[model samples]
Target: MAIVEVIVPQLGEGLQEVRVTRFLKQPGDRVERDEHIYEMETDKANVEVESPYAGVIVEWLAKEGDILPIGAPIARMEVEGVVEAASPVSHAPQSAPTPSAPAAPPREPVGVGARLELIIPPRTRAYARQKGISEEELRRIPAASGNKLMPEDIDAYLAGRSETAATAEYVDYPLPQQQRAFIYRIKRSSQLVVPAVLRRPARWDAVRRVVEQFKSTPNAPVHPSEFQVFAYCAAQATLQHPKFRSQLVGEDTLRQYPHVNLGIAVARPGDELVTALVKNASALDFVSFVRTLQSQIRKARAGEDQADASIQLLLTYMGGYQMVDAIPVLVAPAVAILFAGEAFPVEGVPHVNLVLTFDHRLINGVGGAEFLNAVAQNLENAETLVQSGMAG
Candidate 1:
C-alpha cells in the first residue's frame, strides 16, 4: 500500500491559515473521495475540508483547535496507484462539529498564582494573554455553558466583572454559520464605524388604519406586514434622501447604489438572526413589496443565504418588544440602518418609536435626523403608500 499525505487545501484568497475544529473519521476508517474528513475555521468563516481519495486514514497530523497554514499536511492515508484529485476547497463555512470527549475533572481551587492549561481557540488564549488574565481568574468566571470555554464567554465574563457582578452566568452558544457573518459585521461596525443615532416617536394610527382598510376591502391590495409597511416607508424615504442608498468608499466620496436593496433582519427560531433582501424596494409599490417580502421569508426558511452582504440599506423591527426604540449599529460601507420598536396605544393614538443610525463618516447628524423623519412621515401617510396597485 502506498501511503500518501493529505494536506490542508487553500480555502480562499487572503485566508492563509485555519483552526482544525473537528475530525470526522478515525485513523483506521476508510474515507471516500469528496467526503468531508475534517472541518477548519478561519477568523471570519468555518469550512469543511474533504478527502480527495478513497483510502484508509493512516494518522491525523492535526488536532482540534490547532492552527495550520494552507498546504500543510493534515493527515496520512494509504491508497492505491493513480491517486485522484488531491485538493479541493470549499470557501463557505460548513459544519464539522467534533463529538465531545469525556470532560476533565473540575480542578480544586489552587493558590492565587496557579497556572491552568485549558483547551480553547487561539483567539481566546491570545485575548487572555493580551489582557494579562490568568487561568485562575477564568475559573472564577461562571458560565451556563458546556465543557469548552469560548472567546465570547471570556469576553462576557470580562464585561460582567467590570460591573462587579458577583455571581454571573453567560450563555455560550455554538456558532452557526449564518450567525458568524452577522457577528463579524457587528463587531466590525463597532470598531471603526463612527455612528450617529436619531430616535423619533411615529404615530402608527394611520398605519393600522391602512392595514385594516386593506383587509376589509374586497379585491384590495395584498395586506402587508407591519415590517413590510416599515420597509416601504424606509424605501420611499430613501428616494427623498439618496444618502441612505450610498456607501462611503473614499475619503470625500460616497458611492450610491443604482438600486435600493433593503435588508430585513429577521430573528428566526433558536434566537438566530438572518437577513433577507428586498431588492429595489423603493421601486416596488405596496402590493409588489408585500409579495417580495413573503418571498424573502420563504427563501430564508429554505436555508438559502438570506443575508445579502451587499444590501444597500437595512430595516429591522421589534414589534412585540416593550422598548420605545433602539440605536442600531451602522454596518460599514452602508451609510445607515433603521429600527422600529413595538407600537403602543396612548390616548387612542398608536405610537411606535423609530430610530435611524448612520455612519458619521459620510452622513452628518442633521442628515440622519431628516432621513428618519422622512421615514416616519411616509408611514404616517400609510394611505399614500398602499393606495396604488402595480406600484413597481
Candidate 2:
C-alpha cells in the first residue's frame, strides 16, 4: 500500500513551529479524509489538523510537545491503492526470533564538577543562545550560580557587554501586582507592535438624550444610569463608524463583523478581571443593551457559562471607579477599545473624558480620532437613544 505523510499546516506570521498538543488518531488506526487528526499549539491559538485522505495509519513520526519544522512529515498512512503479493491457500511455517532482555536505563551524570544544565525561562533561552552563552556558561555566571536565572542575572550580563552587543538580549519585566492582565498585554503588545491613533470627536448629544430617557423611566430594572447610557452611545457609534467595528486579521486584512459585540470590563471578586459581552449591540436599544450587559456581568461574576466574545469594540467604564483616564489595549482580534472615564460636574455641566484606542494597522490616526468624535457627538446628543426605546 502507498504510505501518505501528514504535515502541520501554516498558521500565521511570526509562527515558526507549533507544539503537538493532542492526537485524535493513533498509529494503525483507520482514519477518514477531512477528519480531525491532531491539534497544534501556536502562539496565536490552537489549531486542529485534518487527514487529507482516507487510509490506515501506518506510523506517527512526532510526539506531543515536539516542535516540528514546517512541512515536516508528522505521520504516515497506508493507502488502499497498492497491496503486497501473497501466497494463496497453503501457508508457510516460520520461526520467530527470541525476545531479548530490555537494556539498562542510562545513568545520570555524577559529581559536583559536572556541567550544570541551566533552565532559563521561556522567551529567554533563544536570546541566551544567540549571545554565544551555553546553558553551562549561564550556570557558570556568578549571579546565576545560587539561584534560578532571574531578570537581574540577565540584566547584569548585558550591563558588562557593549550596548550594541546586548541590544537584543532584553526581556520585559513582570507587571505590578495590582495591574490587570488585559491592560498589561494591551500596553506591551501595542508598544512593540501597534501604533496608537486617535479618531476625530464623535457627537455626544444623541447619547445624552438616551441617558436622560433612561433616568426618566419609572421602575426600570436596568439602571438607566450615566454609565449604561455611555455604553449604548458607544455601541451606536460603532454602527455608524463601521471601520472602527472591524478587526485587524492580518498585515493588510481587516475583518468586519456583521454584528457589533460590546465587551464591558468588570472587576470580579478577589480583584480578578473579566469582560462581559453584550452581543449584537446595534440591534438592541439603550435599555435592552444595559439589561443584557448587566445579566452577562452577573453570569461572569457568578462563574457561569460565559462564552468568548467576538467583540468589535470593548467598552470599559472606569467612571464607577476613581480612574480619570486610560489608554487601553486593543484585545487581539478586536479592532478597538473605548474607555469612558469618570464623569465630573464642571460649573454645573457634567462632562466625561472618553478615550478610544484602536489598532493603527486597521484604523489610522485621523480615522480613530473621528470615530471617537462620532461617539462623543452621539453622547452629547443622548436624546435620540432614549427616545428610541427602553429595555423590554
Candidate 3:
C-alpha cells in the first residue's frame, strides 16, 4: 500500500509557522481527496488544510495546540487497497434494503485546495441555533469558506436577506477561539506600537442637546445621538486640521486623506471589536450625517461592517459603561484614536472626558496635544456651529 504524507501548506507572506487549532479527521479515519483535515492558526487568521489523497489515516504527527513550521509533514495515510487494519465481521445478513427504512442522503463531497470554511465557535453556533437559523443556510454563504469565515461576513449575509424568513431568526455568534487569538495578537501589537498620551475632560453640553433634539423629534429624518454628534464634530475638526486626519505611511511621510473617514468603534457582545467607517463625514449635513452614522452603527453592532477605509482618526465612546477615562490603542495605519467616556456632573455642569492616544513615532507630544485641543474646542461650541452649518 502506498503511504501519502500530508504537509502543512503555505498560508501567506510573512507567515512561517502556525498552531494546529483543530483536527477534523482522526487517525484510522477514512478521508477522501480534498476533504478538510485540520485547522491551523496564523497571526492574521486561521486556515484549514484539505487532504491531498483518498486514504485511511495511518498516523497523526501533529497534535492540537502544537506549533509547526510550513512544509512540515503533519500526517500520513495509507492509500486505497491497503489492509493495514482488519475489518469487523458483521452478524446480520447483507440485505439490499428494508421497506420501512429509507436510505440516508449522500454526504456532500469535500472540495480540494484549501477552501474557506466559516469556523463558528460553539457559543456562536448555539446562539444562532437558539435564534432558529439553520446551520445549513449559514454554511451556504458565498464567502463562508477557507479556514474560517469572519463574523462580519455572516452578519452581512443575514442583513442582506433580512426580508427573508431566515433573517428574522438571526442571532450573533461568538468568534472562534482562533479568531480571538488573532484579536489578542492585534491588541498586543497595538499596545506595543501606540502610546497613551493624556486623558482630558470633554465638554458634552452641545452633543447632549443634539441627541435630545433628535430623540424628541421622532419624525425627523435623522435620529441624532451623542455618538453621531461626536462623529460629526470629529469629522469637522479633522477637516479643519488636516494633520489630525492624516495617516503615518512611514517615518518621515504622512498621507492626508482628502475626505474625512471617521471610524466609530463598536464592541460586540463578545470580546471582539469592529469599527464602522463613516465615509466623507465632511460632506454630509447634521441630519444626513446622523442617519448615516446610525446605519453604520447598526450594521457594526450586527457584525456586518468590514473593509477598512482611508480612516483619518478613530472615535470610541464607552460612556454607557460609566467609564470615566481610557487610553485607547490606535488602529494601525491611522495616527490617532479619540476615546470619550461617560458624561458626569462636574461642578454642577455636565461633562465627558476625552482621552487621545496617538502614535508617538509619527506625531510629537505637542502635535498630539494640539489635536486634542482642537477636538475639545469643536465639541465645546458644537451646538452653535452645527446649527449654523445646517442653516447655511
By lDDT, the best candidate is: 1
TM-score order, best first, reads 1, 3, 2
lDDT of each: 0.71, 0.62, 0.68
The residue-by-residue lDDT of candidate 3 on 161-260, one tens digit each, is 6656455566455444334434544553464455658667878887888778767876866667787787788788777677777776545677777777
Error of 2 at 188 (Å): 9.4
Predicted structure 3: lDDT: 0.68
* 111-174 per-residue lDDT for model 1 (tens digits): 2112222334446655764564543354455544764567777788777766764454664423
Please write out the lDDT profile of model 2 over residues 1-392, one tens digit for every residue. Answer: 55555556555544445556678898779988789889875555557877766788776655554455456556667766532221111122534545785656865533321222343443454455556454334445555665457656766776765555557576443222223234433443454346574533234344555555546879755556677777777788777788866765547676786668887777766666667778888778665677887788788677442324266777777766887667776665567788877666666566777777777777877788777887787687676555564533
Residue 11 miss distance in model 1 (angstroms): 12
TM-score for each model:
0.59, 0.55, 0.57
Candidate 2, superposed: residue stretches over 4 Å from native? 1-41, 49-193, 197-216, 219-221, 304-309, 389-392
Ranking by lDDT: 1, 3, 2
Which residue pairs collide in model 3, if any?
A: 115-146, 116-145, 116-146, 117-145, 117-146, 118-149, 124-173, 124-174
Model 1 steric clash pairs: 46-93
Per-prediction tally of clashes: 1, 37, 8
Top TM-score: which candidate number?
Answer: 1
53 Cα displacement, candidate 1 (Å): 17
